[model samples]
Target chain A: MIKRNIFRRTILISLFIILFSASTFIGILDIKLIDLLKLDREAWHNFLYFRIPRSVSIVLASAGLAVAGIIMQAISQNKFISPTTSGTISATQLGMLVALLLFPMGSSFVKFGFAFISALIFSIFLMVILNKIKIKNIIYLPLIGMMYGSIISSITSVLAGMFGKLQTVQSWNVGSFTLLVKGRYELLYIIFIPVLLAYIYATKFSIVGMGEDFSKNLGINYKSVILLGLVLVSIISSLTYIIVGPLPFLGLIIPNIITLIYGDNLKKSMIDIIFLSAIYILICDILARTIRYPYEIPISFVAGVFGSLIFIIILFGRVKYGSK
Target chain B: MAQNKKLQTGIISLAIIVIICYMLIKLIGVRSLFALKMIVKVRFPKLLALTVSGVLVTSASLVFQSIVNNRILTPSMLGFDAIYIAIQTIIIFLLGSVNFLLNPIYNFILSTGLMIIVTLIMYRLVLQKSKNNVVILLLIGLILTTFLNNMVTFLQSIMSPDEYLNLSAGISISLTNMNLDLVLIALPIMITCIVLFYCDAKRLEIISLGEDNAINLGLSYNKEVIKHLIYIAISMAIATALVGPLSFLGLIVVNLTREIFKTNNYKILIIFSGLLAIIFLLLGITILEIVGHITTLPVIINLIGGIYLFYIVIKENKI
Candidate 1:
């Protein structure tokens, strides 16, 4: 146990260092706010004000998404699953497309609200369908999710094509942290705080992970807990997508790494998730900004590509141990 | 007797599906003699390419799954998709969008042939040892995927916005732009594989029972498996080249085929699986066209696949 804790601490320290170095690189390479905007003192002050809100937005969005991912994986009992991978992102895209087409004059908040609700509905419908299927093997799970997600994505693509909005849709779907200015960032915070509290309602989620009969014996309300978890996950995921677009693999990679390192304890994973997700986003931000000097890389691809490697490594290790 | 019935059903289903597809395409203003001529000239050829490509992919996936004794694996686990995507990103970055289809047929054949040769060599080396560990293979694939993704990112970063737009726009699935020559080449390769599969139908069933069982049955399991892998590489190359990677499409189709067909016969299963893929792909495209048309076909496919995936997740009660 001592050895394990020491190893984990080492990992955390290294992660922090990498994140710090990347940020330092960004700071050194990127033009400062004053130089970037080349504005007077008043404008500079306004920029600083917005900067704080954007930082707040990043923190809230990452934490909320991380927690939602944890709750989702725990309840669903599948590490390979995430909102991004499970069609939530597609649903959000669909919602956003509709909002763009139907409510050109609507407020961002109203648009975000609609997106969140629709994504939640879609996710729940998916979960219900999943529950109905009598699975013969576990492999069927991801396969089915992949298929379902593909179908939704196909729909989104077809719709985008017809509306002549494919280009816009693609741009919107490619996640980035560069656009989180003042007004947009506040909306994320408003959504984040309440959802954080609602996560407590899903304490039974980990219990549900213990199996239905086991949970029933413990007098747990499995259905309601699952429902609450789904709602929380969907809301947070949709809002994040609306704010920063859909991040690939962050939702899967963070929680799974947290669980692998911190043990399967949900609360502990939650804590790790908060810090790790922020660090992840920040590092991705650095890579996005600095990779090409002036041009920014989309953060989604960074997380997906890198995070999936980490996931595969862990999976490989598991297989090795199992085979042994 | 059962084999005869199965063969008859297979022929009937294939014919019906093709006719329906033809009718549907016709109904969508391909009705006039001139339009029919146009479809034959333009659409039919492309559609034929897609069909053959689909057959190769499904059959390859089925054989791969059987040999590995795992139902849920795709050749993408070999990192070929990553390599394909990486090559694409780099080529686009270098060439910009200026007649991007410059000798697509040549490029497709060359890259696919190169991939096949290299993978076959690696597969041989791995198979020479203990068979490829599913997880280990996946890890290698993952690592390669990461490396390629990073390279693509680097390329995208350096690329101008116009270049990036051209690259990414063409990156995802769009079957309208396909290479006829590559499809023609894939046709013969697929036919050879199907004939080979037919020749070894019994052996494949025995192999699916497991390595030990197959060995007990005096089958040269490794050789047969390697043959299948080569076939898979060819098929996957063709399909991926034509349509990019549609991961769950084949997985869903093959499983649906097994579920509905309720048979373990490889010969029957192959035809059923191929027909099912065509029907589903056309159906999906039709749905996308008829629906709000506000989204992409892939997004819709992902949504349907995801919901099904989630259902499988909850029901199985495993991570």
Candidate 2:
């Protein structure tokens, strides 16, 4: 068992190294390893200023989203719930609209603040609603979240139309990594704090997954832990959205794939979730850039295509495995 | 007797609402004979498009919910709208900004034929292997919608700004900007499809009693399901092509019909559903007109319909 575990770890680490290097190197500008060795000034400038920041932002956004998904699934005790399907991302988009309207010259910090507050409120509202309903089929939960999301998004679009900012918001909503630059993408670093908090509270989240009664019986502060988990989720998700736009289905799909492979113990699976998320997103980002050659497709579109395909496979696998 | 009285009151109210809507559209601000004539020409086609689209969506939703045995499901869940958007994007992408390709006649034929073929393929893949597990079907439908939406977005990204603007303008379902000639063509196709659906009302009633019961009663359940799905695909395609996609109008209209009429008869359901849909559209359009058409009708419908669906799902689950 130890030997097999070590082998798996080595494979994962090597895969991560390979994908990280490939994604960092493969962009419009050709920066070969030989150029790096010879210290070519132009290649070094592009690598330092553009490629590294782009890769860092991609890793941070995917890891943040995946971690947020894990925290959300743990708290809600539903495997399918995520920021994309739930009203969280749309609420943040709405908040961004409000920010753009109210403070046209505001910094990213002000926008992030508005988005975080709205995301928190909307996600908590959804949690309360989910708690009240006794859903027999778990699938309805995500469907309801999706419908709620559409309503929120429509409201945002209507407001954008009223202000003639529809095109701006539409472009912002489409996730892309090509917009990242050295100074522009530093806001994504804010996610690291919430991700750290998530790791600290991972065990309590697992207990919360067992229900309030179970947590209380174990003498844990159920409300605070759940609140903290939600706060962390909202912060991570909103920050990612503000920096990288919405990464559709990444949250739901990554955590689901992680739990399927590594089991559901949050403490043990946290590292695996983070690493796997980075690798998955790096591969998707690489595909997005290379699929149309010079003109890049949006990262969300590529992620949506791949994530939803895997989601369907997971659903079928559950039906076959769980029923038998 | 109570059900009959309820149906009578519903129909009466629906008629009154339609009449009021017609007056608001035709004579709200008419000043002269020339203006009246102009108003009638524009308003009549707009009203016809509204009525046709509402009927198509509502009837399709009712038939879909009945067949799926789940009131929460709408035909839009089957990704018909995404398919419509994708076809439009491809047309504009390949042919550029040509008016000939964008004409309602060509758009209708292309969208309906493609939607029917795609949905038939999806039905075969989903229903071929197992008993119709609705949850699985719904998941597949949802994922397929996301997949197709992504495809559209990818295409839109590559498109020039002018072409993209044109595509976005026609993307939403709006009665204000509908093609009058296309409405004339779509009205006949929509009516024919609904008539076929109405003809299968008895079979639909049987299929609603669960698949096993329908099969035990000597009905070829799969064959009937396939036939109704084709009918639904064609009507939905026509409606969507004419007015873009109204994702939740059908859900709101059909659920209101079931609540008000409280009937199992598809014939009564179909008629009242059509009436109620027209009333809903007229009322929505009237409100939009009052508000100076700031937002389109589907956005309003989806906002309210989605909230109502959320409420209904929570309430039903509470019981």
Candidate 3:
């Protein structure tokens, strides 16, 4: 069993690295590896500054979001309750809007702060509401979560309209990695901390996900683990929104497909899940960039289209397999 | 209800009249005749569109709840709005700005036809089996809507800026600004649909009583289900295609009417909820008018209605 798990882990990481390199080579500006080896200054600068940052940011964002999703689904014990469905993305957008309105000249870090705070607040609010509700129907949680997101998003749009910032918000809503170059992308590295933290606390999150009673019996502090999950989700999500953009449904789908293939072992499957999410997002990004060559489409567009379709398949897959 | 029928009818008739008169006076203010003519020319079709669209949306939603037997579901949840947006995006992408904007009649027919066909296919597939699993169907609809919307957004990203500019005016859900010409043309069709809804009210109430009950009452449950799907598809397509999509107006109007009027009668529910929709819509338009063009009413309605929906769902869980 140990040997097989190691083999799978190695394969996943290798696949991710290979795709990451491939995505770097497909943008509008071509920078060949052969040119870099020949000590070409332009190739080196473009690759090091533009291609590498964008590709690394993609992997980081998706992996972070995927792990965050696992923790969320585990804690809530609902596959549908990802950051996107639970209003985290919308809350970040609201924060981004407020950051734009109040601190128009502030650095991206300021915006990140606003986004992180609001995202944390919104998810906690959702948690409180979910705690009070009886889970007679599993599907109802995600449905309510979506309604919560829409309410916040509509409010964001209304505010944006009043402030004449609708166009600005629209640009961000496109959710692409087109703008991530060297200096602008350092903030994304902050995502690594939450991801590391998730791994450190994976067992607790899994126990918490089982149920409050199960968690308390195992001597884990249920509320604090729940808070840690929210904070991890918020940090990863908000940072991603600031650095990249709001890539819808990635958080929901990646962990779902991962858990499906690998089972619900957070400690065992977390690394594999991270690697698979990176590969999935890298593939999507590569397709979007090439589909309309010389003019890249946003990643969210491709992800949303395919993500929803995959979600439908999974919905049926669950029924057929009766996995739960 | 038998005892209160006269009182309910009298109150409903009065409320409808009061709302209409108030909206008309608001539209045709006592300004100069030229200004009145200009205002009437612009706002009259909008008022007609809003009123009829309100009735259409609410009634379609009422029938939709019956057909699915779920109170919280809205047609928009099935992504009807996303489909409309996708249709507009595809039109602009394929035909350019001139062909799309120049032929409003063709656009109406094409848009409404496409929406109806799409919804019909979905309803048939979803309702055939798994009758007990409505949430899965709702999830599928919601997911498909997201997929369609993302496709539209991707297409629009690659569109010529001018063509996208044309789509912007047509696609976004706005109550303040509309193609009055299309509204005028669609008025007759919308009125006929309202009449058809009134005609089918009793049958719809029976069908809502679960499939076994509906079947046992000498109603061909399958036939009634098909008819329900057809009327819902046409009305919803026309209404959404006429304006943009109203995500929660139907939910608020239908549920509020059910709560306040204390009526299980589908006949009274149609008119009662229709009036509630009109009042809600007119109030929205007038407020937008008063605030004067900084924001659209649909987004605000979405905000209010979504909060109300969350409240209802939370309350359900509490019980």
Candidate 4:
């Protein structure tokens, strides 16, 4: 039965792969079919070269975000929480604001560094608060996260308003792939790879999630593990926000989708989430570029709409099943 | 004993609201209130609108809480703000600067009405199946909000720069420079909703216990919820359309009401919550106006509300 299930899953996976490939092919065709097909080889090469970096950035950013979200939900033990939902995204935005207004001439690396450090600091504070406050019920935690997120967001909003940069701030906060190019995309890869490695090596993360007491009994340093998790999450998330801007529910939705299909197994879900996020973003990117002809809908909007629909469905299903 | 405590809190909250409103009127740099022309034309009417806005936000929040059976969810979750942004962006994109300056009311009504309709449709669609799950409803609402938000952003990016700037200026919620006419118009509807809510106050409590429980107790749960939902929808439409999305103000006020009154009865909670909301809203506006002399008081409220929510969460967790 297990083998059969695996086979079925593999087949489904293959189908999604086909869909992604076909979509990519069509997307490429749509972009260049008119002029490139009629032009010489050099033009085709130029188009391909130009598109490659942006496509890679979109795929990596989406997958990393999805994986990070899955890890967060697993550690936090709540599907509703995301970097965006938990003020982590806002903290990153705050970092960007400081970088922009305070250190206007700072390099992207320096700005991202500031974002990483600030987000880490903020997220650590949240972890400490969470640790000190014994959560008797789970539902309230998300509310706290939401509130924290709003506070950070409001601060950004107020600052933006005062500085007459609300629109610029909002556009960045909204998260779009429009600005993705060869230069900025590298940063996402750099932050993503190391954090991904650290996450894998941290066996205590899984044990800690089992329960603090259980981990302590098993000689796992729960606080350190959690702090480490927070740091890892902060760095990766901050970097992604810096490069791709804010993806709204990019983190929350894909992870939840994976868990619904694959159950609570973290390792499997992690892989599923990565692949699923890639496919989801690819399709969204394709649609974004395709739907309006010369103009593109921001990928954020596509993800938001599709992600919300899926989230609602999952929530309804979960509620119908009467389980937390 | 409980009733007396609620009544006392209610009275205190009301007094605070009045004081804050008076202070806000003064702080808006509206001196020479004794002058009949300015007072009637600007000062008095502005005060009335702020007062009414506070009542509308609180009562609407209360009714929303009753129907959803959760204090956490608000109508903004249904994408009213998102739709508002979408409409505003589209209007500015299409009309340009001259047309907007030409007819502000036409723009307001058209955009606001479109938002209401779209949000209503989204709410009705997702809310139908998962009426029992508050979390589900909230999740869907957030998703819809994000979708609409994304759509607006996408449109704005492609829109002409002048159009984008024009829409952005108009979109931010502020009570500082509200047109007296708009406030006057919004006031009657706000009061009417409150009156209607007062009449249904008893049923709201029953509905709050969830539809199954309410139905078991021989109440028409669906009917009760439907009515309350409509009230919430209208109230949210007015509040958000009047002023852009004030995320944590309602959350802070509604939660504060629960904390202060320490009761679940709709009549007491709703009434007190309205008063508390007004006080908080005015207090927020006052502090921002007095200290920063800033236009973006809503941001300050959002920050304070966020902190208050965190405090409540920690406190609740402790228990």
Candidate 5:
């Protein structure tokens, strides 16, 4: 087992290296690998300011979303649940709309604070609803959450329309890494704190996954742990949305693929999940930038297409293989 | 006796609401015969488009829910509107706004044809592969919608500002901004689809008895489902092509009809749901006029209908 584990770890590290280099090297202005050795001022400037921050944000957002998905599924005890489908992202959008409307010239900190608070409240509300309801089919839970999301989104749209801020909201609705310059994307670093908390409490999440009664029987404080997990998910999702709009199905598909391949033990699979997520986002971001040459497609577009295709494959594979 | 009274009450209330909306639209500010004629001419097409689309969407959704044997499913859930929006965006992206704007008929045909083709492909690829798992089909449709929505957003980002504005307006549902010629063309197709659905009312009732029971009763379950799905795709395409997608209107109206009418009779259910749709659309238009905002009717419908859907799901879960 140890030998196999070491082999897997090596493979993951190699894959991460390859993806990271490719993502950093390719853009509207290509930086050839040999250029790095020359250390020219232009190349160095672009590398420091443009390429590095964009790649870092992509990696951070993807890993953060994937980790959020895992925590959500763990707390809900439903493999299909994710931040996008669970109404968390839309709730955050609604919160951001309110913040933008109230404080048009507010600093990013104030906006983030409002969004963080609203996301926490909305997610806790959703969790309470999930607890109160007895859902027979796991599918209905996500569908209900989606309905809730649409309601929130419609309210946001209506208010935005009223304020004539539809354009502002529309821009926010489009998720792109193209806008991530050095100073613009530092907020994404907020994800690191939640991700670290997630890693620290990974085992507790696994215990919560076994059910509230089971956790309580094992002397775990089920409610607080579940709340902590949700707060982590909310922070990750809300921060990603505020910084980069929404990337639908990323959270849903990546963690699902990881769990299918690596199993559901969060402690054992967390690193692989994060690495694979970064690799996936790196590939998608590269495609988004290169697809139209000087004009960039949104990162969310590539992710949506790629993620949903994989989602369909995973769903059908489950049906054919009769795997849970 | 009680069922008759309830049906009568529904019809009477719906009729009263329709009349009020019509008057509010047509005669709110008119002062003379000349003004009345001018206002009627403008409002007539808008009202016609509203009524036809209302009937098309609601009936299509009713038949869809019955055929799938799931109360929560709507035709929009099948990715019909997404396909329509994607086609519109792609056309504008490639052909330029002038070409797309000048040729409304061509645009309509292209969008409807593309939606039908996409639906057919999904039926063959995802639906068949899942062995008719409705939940899986719904999930695939949901994913397709997200994919297409993102594609549209991507194209919009690259588009020029003027083109983006036109595209955004084109994609939103508005009773006041519809093409009169397109509505005229859509009216006949929508009526025919509704008639076909009405003819299949008994079959739909049987189909809703769950798939196994229907098949055991000698119904060609898969074949009938495919037929109804085609009808649904055509009507939904026309409705979406006429007005942009109204995601939650169908669910709200159909569920309201089922609750108020309290019968499995597709005939009554279909008629009442269609009426409820019209009432909702007219109410929305009036509300928009009252509020003096540019928000489309679907926003209002979705705001209410989405909440209603959430309530229904939670209530059902509690039971």
Candidate 6:
């Protein structure tokens, strides 16, 4: 078992490296390692300014959300709940709009604070609603979440439209790394803290997953852990959303795929989740750039196409009924 | 015999008339015969479009909800709106704005056709596999919608700013500045659908009662599911294709109709849904126009309707 795990990790990490380099180098501007070695200004500028930040953002955002998904599933006790399906991204978008409207020209921290707060509030709201509903079918969880997200997005659109910032909000909502520059994409790193927090509280989250009564009997603070798990989810959700907009289904798909292989051992499978998410999003980002050549489609589009297709297949394979 | 029902009906009609009059009052300047002809040719079609499409969509949604035996689920979950917007995107992407703009007839055919086809494909995929699990079906449709929505936005991003702007304007449900030709073309089909739906009102009400009720009443519930779903899909596609996508309006209207009319009779409920739809949409459009039409009609309606959906869900016994 140990050897098999090692072998799997080796293959996944190797795959990640290859895809990472490929995503980093393949773009509109042609640059080679030789130019960076020779202190080439233009090559270095493009690499540092656009290509590297974008590629890094891709990796960071994917890794962050993938772990966030695991955290969400554990705390919510439903495999279907993720940032993509839940209202977190939509709430983040709305909060960003609020920040934009309020500050107009505020610092990124203010926007980040706003995004995090709204996502946290949204998490609390959804949990309250979820607690009230006795769901037999797991699909109902994501169903309610998706409707909530759409409603939140509708509110966001109305506000953005009222402010005459509809186009800008629309652009932000479309998850893409094309506009990533040095300063713009750096805020994505903050999501990494939530990821670390996920790792620390992994066991508690899985225990929380069992249900409120079980967790409390096990001498855990049921509510606080749930709050903590959701907070971690909200943080990663809002930060990555503010940075890369939204990577559609990245969170949901990665954890699901990871679970199939590694089971629900969050502590053990965290690295694997990161590896898979990084590689998956790297492939998406590369395709988004290369598919239309000079004019890049958003990574969310590529991810959505691939993710939903994969999700349907996975859904059909496992979910025969709502009986479970 | 209830005064409340009478009062509600009177109130809705009054709101509809007041809003319509307010909208038309602005167009009061038409002294010349040529100007009168212009009003008849141009403004008349838009007024007709809003009223007809509103009624069309609300009825379609009512039938859909009744078929599924769920109050909160709108026909939008059938992936109608997303497919409509997606087809519009593909048209703009392929042949530029001219195909969608100068030739409204082609988009009308292509858009509605694609919408129906997508719905059929979804039906085949989910219904056949799951033996008609509505929740699973809703989930699949929701997934498809988000995917298509993402695809449309991505395409719009690739488009030039001007073209993208035009596409956004065209896709968003707008009350003002509609195509007269498309509205005229859609009017006959929408009316036909509404009439056809009304004919099946009694059967639908039986279905809405519950599966056992439907079965006891000699309705082969499972077999009839596909037929009604197809009808719902086609008419919804037609309605959404006509007036962009008023996704939440249907949910809001149908529920309100049931609440106000307090009738299990699909006939009365369907007619009330139509009138309430016109009242809500006309007032919504009036609000949009009053507020400088800064945003689209669907956005505001969706905002209100979404909240109302949560209200229904929360107020219901945990289903």
Q: What DockQ, between 0 and 1, does each candidate earn?
A: 0.29, 0.56, 0.55, 0.47, 0.60, 0.58
* TM-scores, each model vs. reference: 0.79, 0.94, 0.92, 0.86, 0.94, 0.91
Per-residue lDDT, model 2, residue A184, is: 95
The parts of candidate 6 lying over 4 Å away from their true place are A1-3, A21-52, A179-184, A292-295, A321-324, B1-16, B19-24, B27-43, B317-319
User: Clashing residue pairs, candidate 4?
Assistant: none
Tell me candidate 5's TM-score on chain B: 0.93
Residue B125 CA error for candidate 5 (Å)?
1.5
Q: Candidate 6's residue-wise lDDT over A204-301, tens digit each?
A: 88788888899899999999998888888888888888877888888888899888888887889999999999999998888888888997877888
Clashes of each: 47, 0, 0, 0, 0, 0
- Tens digit of per-residue lDDT, candidate 2, span B1-319: 7868777686868668774666555465667786677566777788888888889988989888888787877888888888888888888888786663447577667777888788878877876644556566766777787777777766786778888777777777745556778888887887787788789899889988878999999999888877777777778887888888888988887888788777798998898888888888788777776768687777888888888887777778641
Interface RMSD, all candidates in order, equals 6.0, 2.2, 2.3, 2.8, 2.0, 1.7
Error of 1 at B203 (Å): 2.3
Candidate 4 is graded, for docking, as acceptable
In the range A105-155, model 1's lDDT, one tens digit per residue, is 888777787777778888888788766656544434544554455566567
TM-score for chain A, prediction 3: 0.96
Please tell me which model should have the higher DockQ, number 4 or number 6. 6
lDDT of 6 at A302: 89
Better of 1 and 3 by TM-score: 3
State how far residue A251 of model 4 sits from its true place (Å).
Answer: 2.8
How far residue A52's Cα lies from its native spot in candidate 3, in Å, is: 1.4
Candidate 2, pairs of clashing residues: none
Which residue pairs collide, candidate 6?
Answer: none
Better of 3 and 4 by DockQ: 3
Residues B174-285 of candidate 5 have per-residue lDDT tens digits of 4555678888888888788878888989999999998989999999998888888878888888888888888889999999889887789998888888888888887777
> What's the CA error at residue B7 for candidate 2, in Å?
4.5
Report the candidate with higher TM-score, 1 versus 2: 2
TM-score of candidate 5 relative to the true fold: 0.94
Question: Where does candidate 3 clash, by residue pair?
Answer: none
